[model samples]
Target: MESTSLQPASAPAGKFLSRFLIITVTICILISPGYIFFSERGGIGFIEGVTVKQLLHLIFPFFGLYAFTLVWGQIIIGTCKPLIKKIFPGIGRFHRLEGIFAFIFALIHPVLLIGSLGAVTYLKYEFVGPNKKIFVLLGVTALLLLIVTVTTALLMRLPWLQKRWKKLHYANYAVFILVFIHSWNLGTDIQGSPLQYLWMFFAVSAGLGTLYRIWRAIVKRRTAMSAQSATASEPTNSLNPPNS
Candidate 1:
């Protein structure tokens, strides 16, 4: 007999909360374009007679920024999973969903940019170095890494590949750094706007979160090593007792 004992009443509530978070994040992403459009009026050319291509071009940064936010949220939810579980036990489910949307918005950013400016022109600006070449290259590199990471994530559902998922997911950190550099340097919308400072705040937050995780890993490793050494020493000491 299959028992329902394995699940608790909180399971449904947790699932509901996870879904609510996913939906809220999605709504935020959708509303960003309108917010940025109105906020930047002349800068975004939202006055009148804006073509679809122009609109997409104007909205590109918002998508890119939102993508970063989603991935950053994934990092936060993951790094603090234990704490998050204590509060919202099922929130872990949102981790994968955030990654999925991050990749989607990231893919859209470049597609829209290419659509606004033909492929050749886009590539020229992105690849050919006049001065801003480095920032463009950083963005391209991050996008390529993001593609691989997300594809690997999807592949993780396969039983054979599950073990390697953690290793592949580490690429997200590198992607975050690359995207941060690219956006901070070349983000026109961020320049001289409140968004610039907000972007910086996120950058610092992500950086600090990453550093703390690395520190935790180091401390954990050292603790494990010390415990192993003590255990090994105990066995040796028993074999050769110190004179009393």
Candidate 2:
């Protein structure tokens, strides 16, 4: 009776905790732009000095970072299933939702910049300046790769594409690397700010997550090989009965 009563109570508690986590993460993503704006610009006073175009341009970085955070979370969650199961129990259900939001924000990041810069200037692509060209290129490349990756993910349900889609999804690792380089070099808010430390932490976490994934893959492959070998040997042993 005690065990039965505790089981029901625990289920509600777990559900409540998952809901709280989802709410907390959503609030953080929504408010991060405001936080970045205030922290870098010294509050609302700076907003008065900027034009709408400038404000939109300023918002690009916030959107980029938002997308990056979502991608990073996806990586961590994908690689660390056990950790997610223990902590963020139900978050796997929201994985696709997170991807959709990340892709939207990433698309907006460049669109806002292009809108602020004007189509012709953005077309020229020289506005980033010579010194910053490489970093800007990295960001552009990351965005392009993100588009491809997300498109493939959306199409993954197709019968013919199901197996191939996973291979294309690996492109996200390249996207992560490119975006990290782009932001570390070009992000104004990241440089000389506490946010830099946070960014670094995420990068480190991603690296560790990637390593864990590789290790898991190796182990899985070896386990499969060992099982196959054992299965093969079993047939031989059966054909020529043991001494016992």
Best of the candidates, TM-score: 2
lDDT of 1 by residue, 1-244 (tens): 2357646766888878976885686577446544764687655445358888877777787788777777767676666666567756667666777788999988898888899888999988953458888888888898898888888877888887799878888888888888878887787766777666666766777777777778888999999999999998997888996789
**Worst 10-residue stretch by lDDT in candidate 1?**
29-38
Best by lDDT: 2
Cα error of candidate 1 at position 87, Å? 2.1
Q: Runs in model 2 with CA error above 4 Å? A: 1-34, 86-90, 241-244
Summed backbone clashes in each candidate are 0, 0
Give me the displacement of residue 2 in model 1, in angstroms.
43
Least lDDT summed over 10 consecutive residues: which range in candidate 2?
29-38
What is the TM-score of candidate 1? 0.76
Error of 1 at 86 (Å): 2.5
Backbone clash tally for model 2? 0
